[model samples]
Target: MVTERLPAKISEKSEEKKIAPASPIGIFDSGVGGLTVLAEIMRQLPNEDVIYIADSARVPYGGRPPEEIIKINQELIPYLIDQGVKLIIMACGTSSSIAYPVLKDKYKVHIIGLIEPGVRAALSATRSGTIGVIATAGTIHSQAYQKTLQSMKKTGLPAGREIKIAAEACPLFVPLIEGGFIETEETRKVAKEYLKPLLKEEIDTLILGCTHYPHLVKVLNALTGGKVVLVDPAEEAVAEAKGLLQKAGTMKGKTFPPRYEYLVTGSVAQFQDVGSRLLGKLITHARQARLPTPERSDGGQVHLPLK
Candidate 1:
C-alpha cells in the first residue's frame, strides 16, 4: 500500500499558502494502545504538534466486521479533520487493515497506517527467515501483514532467501490489555495459548501487530523465552512520519508551543486513565466528543457498534 504524506487542505482562497507546518499531526485508534505510536512520535518528533483521538467508546475493533470497522472510522476521520490535522495516523491495526483502504484514496489529507511499517521492520530484523504476526482478527483476516511479506518475498529480498510467516489473531489481547491485565497470570495464560502455534513454527521474530500488544511484552517475552525478537511498529511508523515531515520541511522545530491535544469518543475518565498508563505520564486533559453515526454511500444509516 502507498502511504502518502501531503500538506493539509488549504483554504480555497487563491492567495493562501498550500501548506502549514504548524498544523498538528492527527492520530486515531480504537483505544489507549495507539498511545504507543503517540509516545514514539513525542520521543522522535518532539517539535511537531500532535492530536490523538481514542475511539474508546467502542474500543476493541478486532472481531468486528470489515464494514463496521470502516463505519467507526467514518466517525473518526471528520473529527480529526476538524482538529486541523495535516496528517492522520491509523494507529489501530484493525482499522488500518479495513478502514485505511477506504479512507486513503478518499481523503485529501495524508493518511498512514501501521501495517506496512511493522511488516518492513519485521522483514529487516528477521535473520531466521521465519516471522510470526499477532494481531486482531480483522487485520489477520485482511492479510495486510501477510500480503506485505508476500509481496516482498515475491520480489525477493537482498539476502535472496524465502521468508516464512505465521499469522495468529489474538482477539482477546486487546480487551485484556484495555482492562489492565498485563503482567498477570491471566495474561500469561492467554499469551501461551495464543502464541502456541507460532512458537511451534520456530519463528525467530514476532511482530506485535497490535499496538496494545506492546504492553504485554513481559508476558510475551516469557512465553517466547526472550529468544524471539519483538517488532513494535510504533517506532517504525513514527520514523516514516518524521521522514515525511522532514521532506516537507514541516518540522515544528522549536518555533511552536507544545500542542499535544487529546480527545475521545468514550468516557473522559476511562480514556485518561488508560491513556496515561500507556503514555507513561499523567494525561491531564481528555475531553469527550460525539461523532456522527455512520451512513451508507446510498444515504442509509449504519447501525452497528462494537465494544
Candidate 2:
C-alpha cells in the first residue's frame, strides 16, 4: 500500500481532473511481448481505445537491475499519462514482478499488473496440488508467483493438501518470440528443454509467467501433450480490467470502433513486422517514440515531445 510520489507535472495532470471513460487504456512492455496482453484487451474490451508502447530499445528488462527497472517505468508511465490514458497495464512479467510493487499506488491512474491475475487463474486451474511457473529470469528471481501461490493456497486449496510450486526461468523465450520464431522446430526443441524440469515435477498446471510465452502456446501445448493447463495472465488481467471499468462506470460506449495506436522506442518497421504476425493482424499505424532522457545534471525536469 506504499505510494511513491510522481513528478509535479505528471501528478498535477493525472490528479487534477477526472479521467474520461473514452480515453485510451495504456499498456506497455519492454518489447513486442506485450502484444499478447494487447490481444486479450482487444478481444475482451473491444470498445476501449488502446495505446501500446514497446520499449524495444531497452528490450529484455529481465536482465536489468531493480533500480533500472523502476527508473524505466518512471519514464514510461508519465509518457502514457501524458497521452491521457484512463488506466495502465504493466504487461511485462519482469515489470509486473519487480516494478509493480514499487509503483503500484504511486500514480494517480489505476495501474494493473499481470502477476496477481495469473496466480489466481493458476490456483483455480490446478487439479492437483502441483503447479509450475515459467517466466523470465527476473520474474522467477523475484519469487512473485511462487510467494503468491503459497500464500493463496493456504485458503484457496483444500485443507491439509500440500501445495508444490515449481518455477523455471526461460531466458531465451523473449528473444525467440521477438524474432518471430513461434512455431519453428528449433524453438520447439528449446521449449522442451526449458519445460523438462517442470514436467519432471508432474505439475498439472503451468502458468505462462511471461507475456511472450503465450506466443509459444502451440509449442508448449504440443510439448505438454495438452495435459498441463497453460494459464495466460493476459486473459485474466483483461477480464479484471473490464470488471473494474464496469463497476466504476468507466467502460466505453459502443459508439465507434476502438482506436489502436502502437508506439515503440526501437525500430517501427521491425516492431510492425514481428508484432503483426504475433497478433495475427496487420499493423498499419506503428510509430517510433522518442522518450525523454534521464534526469539532467542540474536536476531540471525533462519534457516529452508534443503528440
TM-score of each: 0.87, 0.90
Steric clash pairs (candidate 2): none
**Per-prediction tally of clashes:** 0, 0
Which one is best on TM-score?
2
What lDDT would each prediction earn against the true structure? 0.79, 0.85
Residue 79, model 1: Cα distance from true site in angstroms = 2.3
Candidate 1 regions off by >4 Å?
1-18, 154-156, 293-307
Q: For candidate 1, lDDT tens digit of each residue in 1-307?
A: 1111212232322231244788889898878889899889889988888888877667678877888888677666755675667778888888888888777876666788988888888888888789999999889999988988888764435656888899999988987888777788888888899999999999999998888899888788888789999999989989998888888887777886667877776567877777787678898777665554432332332333443
Alpha carbon RMSD to native, model 2: 6.2
Q: Tens digits of per-residue lDDT for model 2 on 1-307?
A: 1222223344424443457889889999988899999999889998999999888767788877777788778878887887888899999999999999999988888999999999889888888989999999999999999998888886677788878999999999898888888899889999999999999999999999999999999899999999999999999999989988988889999988899988777678889899999999999788767655433222332333222
The worst-scoring run of ten residues by lDDT in candidate 2 lies at: 296-305
